[model samples]
Target: MATLTATILAGGEFSSPTDTPSGRLDTTGAFPFVGALEVSNSVSTYKGSAVAISSNWILTAGHNADLNDDGLPDTVWSGDFHLPGYGVFGIAETITHPDFSGFANPFINDDIALMRLASPLPTWSIFPSLGSAMTGDNITLVGFGRSGYGSYGYTSNATLTDRRFGQNVIDTLDLDDEGSGLAEVFRYDFDDPSTTGLPGGSLGNGTETIIAPGDSGGAALIQTVGGWKLVGINTFTEGYGGRFGDTGGGVLIAPYEDWIFTETGIPEPGVGCLLSVAFVLALWQRRRHCE
Candidate 1:
């Protein structure tokens, strides 16, 4: 485990295991919903990250469905995603926010989308809800992204981590390019081990971790009275020259609760209980360290 933290403009890995820092651990137990998208029927063809909001519906970044500029997809991978164990799930539908433009100005307005699986998952998992996020709140990020930054930029498939979780604190809310206030986004500081006075990050091993390229559409989990609640989906990391500690935020889900419930047919948020560990949805538990 190497403690090298940098923004994955798009991924990273480490050298020897004893490099004086730390490495991201595999997220087999911590995140049950966290999974990768192997596009075009190939695991080696890392499309991006996706999380199961419901057994039959997955949540991911809107841009994952973007078409290639040349209009030829052979240059870029597309189509159904192949999940290990669970098999392939074709994209029955993709719904990005109507107001969403590409990753240009005001990217925070709406960068999320929901994908309905052609088939349902084997079991029902605890679905995350649209909740509030405030600055200084400690959150956990879980993704199937690479481990470190590479020569060109963030490393991809370098560590080949299936699921990686890290800790980070909310740094700011939404502010547009010109420093004007925006109503939709919440930002977090990307901690570089070199910097002093920053949150420990989502990875609790004292290692400063970040969302790599493959981490797109990952889960930003916040501690709640009822275990951990999924609040935001991994979206963009804004920084100059792909540096660490840049502003990374996503579409605040709380505001779109109505749209998410209506579109996905997951039923309106009425009663949600812990699915895996079998806890009451209203238990109001606290995470051990992130609190």
Candidate 2:
């Protein structure tokens, strides 16, 4: 594995190593909706990440759905999704966005897809609400990707079964990333706290990190007053692999919200207005009692 010198963020001085290859593990079972995707055909098997958006619908990167690279989705592909604690479920169907360029194109856009599970997951399964990402927003990323420290980047020794959590802030919104002529994406750099004057200003939240192979289709979420919202779907990265200073981002969910809802028939959560009504009713009852 390769390694880089550790620099302190404050004074630009050398410092002892404080980062590790393994991102913070999700041992507490906080992310039940996030899961691993294993799709296979007669020739090969592909590993990626996905998140449950509804009881029977899953959201993932478009590339994962088109494993054969036929310009059309491999709807007939055999696959199973493994959600921690919930057991594995077979995939019934897949739908990739209409505008997604095939894998042959280096500058692919509209890299989003949805899968229907053979059976509905448990009602208690926590599906993240849909929302948009903005620059400087602290986002939570969860996936079963290769693991390694920023100093050395991702290592091939890691397996896709290793579920990990990390954090980073959105630094830029690229409207024409890869010149795909698509909508904007939420992009961020893997900042090393020890390094200063890096692009995006070394905004490491201690857990600063980036996505690796097998992390495609992972969840990029943001916490809102209502709850956690699914904001981006992990797609691609640029730089010397997943090393520090590399830029990685995913398809923003906002631009594709209508398409997702139309395909899945799942409505966005109405918690915001519903909660307000409930609170107002409770206050009225309390005043009536006081009178």
Candidate 3:
């Protein structure tokens, strides 16, 4: 319910992209986190957003799991994971922080969720790597969230921008009583004359890259160890100031690696699924040999 203003990149005006061809996970050369999260209740299925941080796990907002507005507990799901060019995979597991409550108070820190897969994905070409708590560095953001007054849906590719802040929650929202997280990353809008304290220049200017309906739990990457590193997971986003100018919030990932590892232990869901398949294959092999 809090609001802030962010500048929108004018038509025909946007950031320059890396000349390198975007890989398979890249959606429209923009934010690929838009269509990742898919929630299923008995009545119907709703699509949230998510990003594949590791081969077997995905990062997403915790609110996606809070099924009822009353905030008891929602059925968490990971089965909707899909690459732009790849088919959908069934999620074998869902995990969240043991301490996550459906409330927003501390502002930042506690809005991230991770899901384990039954098997690690062999490949996803265009996916961006994750990053950590270093500010001012540049990164890209893409989502199917609201772009402008008339814009919506997933992006085919991502837009690059300089990061303004690192590892902090910029905003928060309550979804049907369940709290959602928002990770703040700043990008400058060169087009806005008032960018430096201009009248409508609170939200950093660029293509409005905030998450809308389908973008949650997507990965936030930073350059580390020679490649883009996974740093944060999209948790919550809201239309701050006006609707166009807004910020996204997510959970910083590095701190949660241990929890993720411990919670998702070895012989992961993926391994189990693989083992089951193998058993079936072995049974078939024995039958054929006997025949």
Candidate 4:
């Protein structure tokens, strides 16, 4: 499991995770992977995070799922996820990587987690539409995070913000020029600080947006192809704002298309085996001719 630590900004000071209330929305909008997360611990009490990925598999941060008292990953559990109209669903299985280290300082490694479901949920499986790749790329950040505006509720809107490379790192998008298609992977660090509009960003005291306790594992989707495609999972945050009052924060989303293929293995094992056998036979004949 990778040691998962919260990153506020690249060089900016760190801020603790806060459970602020995000304003309420219609709650009728599509929430992908809404009810897909559950925490595991016999004694220690922990709240369930979000699971914003696929139907069979759920994606989260390594810190939220690492509950084995030994800093090692054991198993994650989910009774149900708190969806909008629907209630929670019974979680079947949880798979946490043994290499996670939770959010720590010096932000060197990655902090990611995974969970599996016994039964699939078709309605919740549809991923959000993704948008173009560019720095300052306008995107929406929806979740049950702290509003930082005095109220505690879930937020749902297609707000715009700069889509940086990573949340905290120096690398951001080069939106000045763009290529065609959406095949490029635009990564954004959670801890990267904003330069201009933050409360303290310009003064060297700015923070980044953070996903509080309830917002863990939620989805950050972008508009693309008349639909929403997931970009990252709600991870943590610092204290800064993007276009709106909400500053960008750290997130841990599963790699969109690539992860899907890996989790749902294409070509099937049987088909792969058949292809391998045919290649071997052909090689054997070629060797015989040489002999």
Q: Which candidate is the best by TM-score?
A: 2
Counted clashes in each candidate structure: 24, 2, 43, 57
Q: Against the hidden true structure, what lDDT does model 1 obtain?
A: 0.57
What is the C-alpha local distance difference test score of each model?
Answer: 0.57, 0.73, 0.44, 0.41
Cand. 2 Cα-lDDT: 0.73
- Over 26-94, each residue of candidate 3 has an lDDT whose tens digit, in order, gives 434344332345567776666555666556666666555655532224654325665454446556766
Residue 67 of model 2 has an lDDT of 70
Q: Measured by TM-score, how close is model 4 to the native structure?
A: 0.54
Per-residue lDDT tens digits of candidate 2, residues 1-291? Answer: 211110111111122334454435677877888888888877788788899999999998888878766557875578788887898889998888876765525444578888999999999888899988889888888887776656655554324455777778898886744454545577887776765446565545346777877777889999888788999988777777676777778889988888997897666457667888999999999999999
Q: Considering TM-score, which of the candidate structures 3 and 4 is the better prediction for this target? A: 3
Off by over 4 Å in 3: 2-35, 69-73, 76-78, 103-109, 123-131, 149-193, 196-208, 240-244, 265-291
On lDDT, who's better, 1 or 3? 1
> Higher TM-score: candidate 2 or 3?
2
- Tens digits of per-residue lDDT for model 4, 63-95: 565554333455443344444444455556554
Better of 2 and 4 by TM-score: 2
Ranking of candidates on TM-score, top first: 2, 1, 3, 4
TM-score of each: 0.70, 0.82, 0.58, 0.54
Best-matching candidate per lDDT: 2
Misplaced by over 4 Å in model 2 are: 1-17, 104-106, 156-160, 176-182, 196-199, 268-291
